[model samples]
Target: MEYPDPKRKSNMFGKLLMAAAVTALCIIMLKHSPSFSTPTHFSRHEKGVTHVLVTGGAGYIGSHAALRLLKESYRVTIVDNLSRGNIGAVKVLQDLFPEPGRLQFIYADLGDPDAVDKIFSENAFDAVIHFAAVAYVGESTTDPLKYYHNITSNTLMVLKSMAAHGVGTLIYSSTCATYGEPEKMPITEETPQVPINPYGKAKKMAEDMILDFSKNSDMAIMILRYFNVIGSDPEGRLGEAPRPELREQGRISGACFDAARGIIPGIKVKGTDYKTHDGTCIRDYIDVTDLVDAHVKALQHAKPQNVGIYNVGTGKGRSVKEFVEACKKATGVDIKVEYLPRRPGDYAEVFSDPTKIRRELNWTARFTDLQESLGIAWRWQKAHHNGYSSS
Candidate 1:
């Protein structure tokens, strides 16, 4: 039999292909319209377990997020260099999960490309919650190189690794340090980000890079600029068990715990001359769990080629003296406070508006009551007096 006209067949095929393309594009627009902007159907794993990579999982907030993730039924892989992280936090998590694939820990640094490569290759992660960075403002100012290398360079490495591994979603643990002394009372996401110190500068660099990277790729990036992150797991299990030998007794809440427990002579109140209700700095402190909940929500809201910048806090500013007073009341001890000069790069009064994260993510800091959160922290510190020391 003679075949039909080849040109006619070709034209028919072209018409069918055009129709399919139009249908797909219509579906895309429908899904992405303002009404469907908030996707109810989230990305998932083959076995329905969303695998997440938590860099710096042995550190303070990282560990807490990891624990929260595991509880939320996400498979977690924790990577830490142990430079500033304590293995004790990992021990606590391992004791709780006690499963191989459910929760795994890798002793690696984000600065090491080879290490990052191995991690991304082995684990099929659906998302990455990046908490690995040099976090001390004073230390970042003194050693700017370390901050740049760790925060900026290391974060870039993580980004590249995720891109290579085809992981498109990232929950970046940023800081209000990027805001750098906002002139306003409650800092909004639109506040001017003029970092005074190297730490904030490094974070700003990373944020810019991440935003720029998303411009070229299909990555979904969520940058949570955290204010003062205080409080523990509330169950006294996962708290700020910073390495005691490292002397992480400088954080306001931790210092209060130490002073109350006599671990430190007194909680040093830095900068008794700032322009605030009290002569000390004011910061918006959010519970670690609440902060991680925002992370989780960001992950849920993530879409291909999406970028979200949010200020994570309770929106209420608390002064240093007020925090000290709350600590005293929480621990039932008159914690001594010694006034000291304000360190460089210190913001006069920094808090959050939180209206964006609240309206969008439907999240609010439920456990941000200063005294109540401090009470939980005091209990944790009192129990783990040595901060998970083998001694």
Candidate 2:
């Protein structure tokens, strides 16, 4: 047999060994990555709430929050009309609840007095998280009646029902739109609301109703003024399912969807002439998961005086162009570029002060990076093409 030199043979063996070691390391890394490993964790248990009622619990943000509550051992009763929400989100909860008896779902709208009455009569909820509202600023401008009727009047009805039921605690989904164009850089909870649009006005009206109800009745209220709510469940469970007619920018998953389908040949930017580092609108985007945690904290605070308002957002403003660029990098998609005129009622830059939420509730936003949140959202969107409704 022809034998090679020992040095050459040793070199060949060493190369094979190195390649095997590298291969093993890569496998370990891939297993721990978000693609393979779950990003969500069941952190803590909720010992206080005997029963918590969630209105619009089947919707985008509501559904995820409901899931978190269930994981934390809270008895949740979801009241939804299923008008804007998906049944798939509900079904996921149906399966996960260890004891189905603890989970109750009332298929009723806040508009119906009888339905609202029935929910109040049956369940003795310790807290109520109201996510039920018609939330679309542009559409609200055109259809003010619908906005006012549903968001305002319907909220009044819910409050009346809550009062009747003696539900002492309430958490409302308010909007950063309530601020409109701010005189200052970052919007705080103390800023006097000057809503330029009907949707913002509607939210403000509902907030007023809630506050009024809290004053008159024995109710504690936490009004969460949300910025741009983006991202989805880290486990591909739930995500944004915006109304097709009212869907807008800020959510990178939807933009990624457009790129994946080749509907947008390139990134089509709406406006690029605004006064910012980039000539586009900047918004503070918070992850749906982090937002869920804030709601739980608000619910936990017992005393009536502890119930106050807080802004739920990343606190960092991300411009529209910057977000798009992040999407391109994350998804490896060449998003087309097309600049048009600026959207009416669009603020140049709207971020949160974030001091109130941290100081009051002792809760700080964990995911400050927009790209990471968007990355999670993009992956969830890629897997569930039809959104949470389809899942």
Candidate 3:
């Protein structure tokens, strides 16, 4: 015992040398690897510039919002999966804002928590405008689970990432569908959220989650429950370009445009027997330009520890027949219309009471003329007949 064990001592010394060698190798690898280096795109963030994340920036509304933010000198980063969005839209933005640090696009699905976490860790975001979702009401009815997973679960993931990263501002793109056939006219913020379809239910669930989260956190939150969004960028830069396969379940504007362009033989009016003035369903059609204006206003008014819920729509309800006539007049095409029975779960009429938004946000639907709005959107559609595929 006094002499000690030389063999044991030698073994311990050998192990120590091996450990040091391994540690040195790891350090060398880390220093030389590009993967471990800071991302160049993130390094371009200006010191005082506010960076906004647009979740579905490749889609119609999200793209317009990004354009507005860029024009206002705010840094914009668009993250879209391109599942239902167009790469062409992203390209258009990039072309418009070619300067570095002004705009960036990340092709990522928010459903992936790990990817979202990576995005948060890499970049500094001042706010998030969440618009990525499967928005087809008919598709939501047939495939309820898809809507819940895409809209509800994905929103939760984004919120968690934002909270973890301490991003305090969020502007959620909600739909008027959450009101779900309200008993009264001009649905307000107080409308009971008894959603009728899976789309509305999923959005309402997301809204509830955001509200619950906001109660304890100091995050600034704005939920814009908008009516049927129509029109385009007004500058003819962006427009609705839903996939051809989804035409049957797509928006009425797209169907009308398709019929006008002769892509379809005629447009089908799904609800003809509703108890409206024209015996068809009536809806508040808000132009995309006005909708994006509301988003910008909401962002400007956002404050930590506060929440704003507003209905972004014109306080006027237009019937299906009226909209069709406007569309025909705008396109200057005698688009044949085939009237059909009312679709299930459809409300007779759904409009919004924009008094609160007007009083608070100081925003109103400037492009209120239905024919004018349709005409502007039709101009973009006529130019991009193939819908970004032409680009």
Candidate 4:
């Protein structure tokens, strides 16, 4: 048996007190933190849906889906407030077709009951493609009330209007973030959703509410939980606008443009030294074109029993470092990179299990790979230098 030294005991006591204080502080912070709180493995067919109402149709994914629907000769009507979506996207659509009666856009917020009523009155839409939710994970984590109000409550309003208007089918824009940190790699539709952030919780809540509605009403819904949606439209007419959170992602395109202009600062690598092969967070990123194609299918063939979930992603995973290197090769630039600590709440690896869509919808991703997709993104970004921004 040994006696504790007085000095050592004092130091140990002090350390324990400090640790306790820190833990208490953390507990208090978590308690005070603003908080907020899918689709299936299958989709099917219910015929006779012609007119489609695309909420947030002016947004990146929604706009692309709108364009695809129009090309397929489906009458498309868009409702967007131009909050995150760009008016420029609408103008581009107008310019691209230059034809009347293909698509209609209404600059209205669904949060407004009057606007919802007006839209319902104006068109006999058979289905709706909703992409109107605020999506930044960090933002939702900080301001959960905002996320709940905009995505959940506002979405409830939209659904109420849809039910009133007899719109029976819905294709929801869900997120992989709803799954939070996965227990396994390449998360599947069956993965238990344990979202760590309010944004994810809100999305999950919305899905639950929609399902609850289905139990009562004659509603057919397809929930698509998308992983990372990267790349641009192959036509160069559509692409993701510059959002504050994804500025670094935009930098890949910017670096490409700069290289094309004979200047090169390369790219910035935010984090590295993770468990991934390239020591960075790995994610499954799908091309936007492929994503839009999947939406088109969901819209075309959605049966009552088809109300299920699908993971829209390239089955393969790519680390952030790998993605940047691919961007460099795609742009033919030896991009420079600087590593920092991993971003808060960033997972070491998260990807999708896309087998359900492949087996059920007979839909598999086609067209560009990551490198090729980045090439297209680079082109579109360079072409539309200042035409749009995501605020």
Per-model TM-score, in order, reads 0.86, 0.83, 0.92, 0.80
Worst 10 residues of 4 by lDDT: 36-45
lDDT of 1 by residue, 37-85 (tens): 5422122245687888999999989999999998988888889998877
Q: Which candidate, 1 or 2, has the higher TM-score? A: 1
Best by lDDT: 3
Clashing pairs in 4: 39-308, 39-309, 40-308, 40-309, 41-309, 44-301, 44-303
Query: For model 4, what is the alpha-carbon lDDT of residue 132?
Result: 94
How far out, in Å, is residue 6 in model 3?
A: 20
**Which ranges of candidate 4 are over 4 A from the true structure?**
1-49, 243-268, 388-391
| TM accuracy, model 1 | 0.86
Which window of 10 residues has the lowest lDDT sum in candidate 2? 37-46
Count of clashes, each model = 0, 4, 0, 7
Better of 1 and 2 by lDDT: 1
Q: Check candidate 2 and list the clashing pairs.
A: 266-336, 267-335, 267-336, 267-337
By lDDT: ranked, best first: 3, 1, 2, 4
What's model 4's TM-score? 0.80
Candidate 4 structure quality by residue, lDDT tens digits, 113-136 = 877876775566778899997877
After superposing candidate 2 on the true structure, give the runs of residues whose Cα lies further than 4 Å from its correct spot: 1-49, 243-253, 263-267, 388-390
Candidate 2 structure quality by residue, lDDT tens digits, 262-327: 745665566788888988888888888999999999888745744588898877898888888777
- Which ranges of candidate 3 are over 4 A from the true structure? 1-36, 39-47
